[model samples]
Target: MRIALCALLLTGLLVFPGVLPNSPGHLGSLAETALPWFGLGVPLLLVWAAVRRSVKEVTCVLVPAVAWVALFWPGIVDFGGRDLGRADFRVLTVNVGGDRTAPRDVARRVRATDADVVALEKVPGPAMHAYEKELGGRYPHHAVGDTLGLWSRYPLRGVEKLDLGGAWPHAVRAVARTPVGDTAVYAVRLPSVRVGLGKGFTVQERDASAARLARRVADDGTPRVVLLGDLNGSLRDRGLAPLARELRSAHRQAGEGLGFTWPAAFPLVRLDHVLVRGLDATGSTVLPDLGSDHRPVVTGLRAAR
Candidate 1:
């Protein structure tokens, strides 16, 4: 028991680097949601050490306990207190649960945000008409690609489909003629990751797709670019390192809290995101659930000078 606890302590200190041979696999990616909870194991070992009255065991437990605190303390405490200089406009992204989520409910939430642009994924053919009718009045310009769609108050130009190695059109790009300037917006939905005993973690497709998306974003010459939708991988995941290096997450810069936005009932992981390049994020936050499993992510941005 002492040896096992000591090993657990050491693992916590290592922070689960991705290159390790026995690394948690798909489990590692999902494990991030409950990273802080791993610290709870340290207390159990401490108590066991106390009962055994073993000095060595107590000393070992301290290593992991301290390591866990050092790693997660910043994430737990909100450091999101920057005075958003001047927001030009806001964008909201939501996965409207295909045909399951009522169009009226989704439309109500979109109306509530009053965002300049709105991006939705998993939009079904059956519910397309309803959304068009409900959002058409407020947002005059709109485009749909496969199951994804974007609605904008500004004029949409140079609309094009984006193929991120998906069989269907899961991504599209358009130039929004805003009051300040024309901004490139990409609404995308990456392939979902799966976990199974045989495959352990299934994200090779998602990773490949992410790489393609990163390449496209890097190649874009637009002065201002914004990506809105479900990438299925969080900013922290190494698989998303390419995109992470090229784009900046709004939540990291201006969100007021942890900014988690999945399983809206009790968000554990942030699968949805608003990432930008050549623009400054003034404010970012998660909105209340719109009768969908994933909550909406909204961000205010300013064109970078």
Candidate 2:
């Protein structure tokens, strides 16, 4: 009986990670998403069995309880993010919809944060100057490309455009020198995935962008780096494998709740993200919408030991 109970726990532990990828139907992704929730039901059942003097059943419960602990403990315990000794500068990233007419208002809000550095995605041509004008004084150091831009309270260097596989100007990579240290920031917006096209989510575009991001970060060798934007897919989805392997989501580590940021009216999935590598994210959260479909993700990062 002990042997059987131990085996059951081991099997559940091994199977849990694969459930979503191998859903019951080959399996499907939905099952993967739902399996963990089903896991909660077992604990309740175990309690009832215990009260009934079902010694054998109670012992069996240990299998899943232990397995789940072994699988998820690292995420739970290692959350403080490497904890580099130096204090981190505050960084803010926003999608800043390309169509927004008043760059001043957007700039006003961005400037209000007074973050050490700011990274922007989906910047439209018309709003560029307003952003420039509004943030001009505070963020003296600046870098601008066709679409994406970076503004910093400190000096900026190594400004360049990143190719996200579609057209030009979807992403940019830059270096900012803060009083604390120098760090790399990537402002990226993956291609939009439309459910109606029969093509499903634009995984191709996201994959290509991930590939580029992986290479850039690999070569950057900066002590700290951040990738910010609307990835359009949840962490559970495999499309973000490349980026996921190298970075940690600030939301997963310090944000309140799930930190959902999409479909602002009623967020379901956390599409937009702030991923960190070679740094410790001390805090993360989702801010109220500034009129865009996606809400903003605010993350505070420090250097990693």
Candidate 3:
């Protein structure tokens, strides 16, 4: 019985990858929504093995234990990033949770970052004025469409709304004339997904929205592109695979630690991202929670010379 139990635990550990939340199917949503929690199983299994004190059983458990660490240790530890010198631009992305977060406070926190560009999502209609007034001096150039907005210190041009197969446009594109060159920036907010007993993490809409966003990104002619937004899904989720293939996630490339940014009180998953192409992210990180459900993500990107 001891050996049999150890074998069962080992099988689960080895096969965990098969259950990773990387696809658009229903099963994938459950896995994606709770991807981080999967690591806890390793500790639980370890405790069980120690309690049994069977030499053979404990030895067998080591296989799955090593596998778990191999898969998740990188995220758990802050491997740090290379010193790429000064960055040309600093960008901040945040979902201010509509009325749940105060616009003045949000603007104040953003100002503190001294970001070159700020992308905001879930801006309620009434709070627009407050944000505009609060962010005016710092960011001279601004664009707003539906729930998405972009505030930039640099000159913004050709601002256009993007239709991501939603009721209203939830994304906007603009060109920022920076010291390095003209860089295309996108402020987007993909449809939210649910993780519950009903639909079991419904992501059909999010998947479609991601697909549309991916096509738009691919068609963009800009040599340098930066996408800032509340992606509503983690990088591990396969629905965003198209975008992932086209761009590099700053958090994965240069961030410290896991960089999770949702449920700000205690972020367990990363639903926000800064994805870039043709630019190098010198660093990426999640800022301290600013009274919103989603914590902001800040990244420094250097335009290619």
TM-score of each model, paired residue for residue? 0.86, 0.74, 0.90
Off by over 4 Å in 2: 1-87
For candidate 3, list the clashing residue pairs, or say none: 22-238
CA-RMSD of model 1: 3.0
Comparing 1 with 2 on TM-score, the higher-scoring candidate is 1
RMSD of each: 3.0, 5.3, 2.7
Worst 10 residues of 1 by lDDT: 17-26
Kindly list the per-residue Cα lDDT of model 3 for residues 145-210, writing each as its tens digit.
Answer: 988899999999999999888798969999999767888999999998886665577788998999
Lowest summed lDDT across 10 adjacent residues in model 2 is found at: 23-32
Better of 1 and 2 by lDDT: 1
Compared with the true structure, what per-residue lDDT tens digits does model 2 show for residues 53-159?
77777777766666656644444454544332223677777777678436777777787765677877778877787788888888988887776778888788888
Tens-place lDDT per residue, model 1, 4-89, is: 56747456534774543324466655555345556767878878888899888787787787787676565456665543435799
In model 1, which residue pairs have backbone atoms overlapping below 3 Å? none
Q: Once model 3 is optimally superposed onto the true structure by TM-score, how far is the C-alpha of residue 53 displaced, in angstroms?
A: 0.9
Q: Cα lDDT of all candidates, in order?
A: 0.81, 0.68, 0.83
Q: Return whichever of 2 and 3 wins on TM-score.
A: 3
Better of 1 and 3 by TM-score: 3
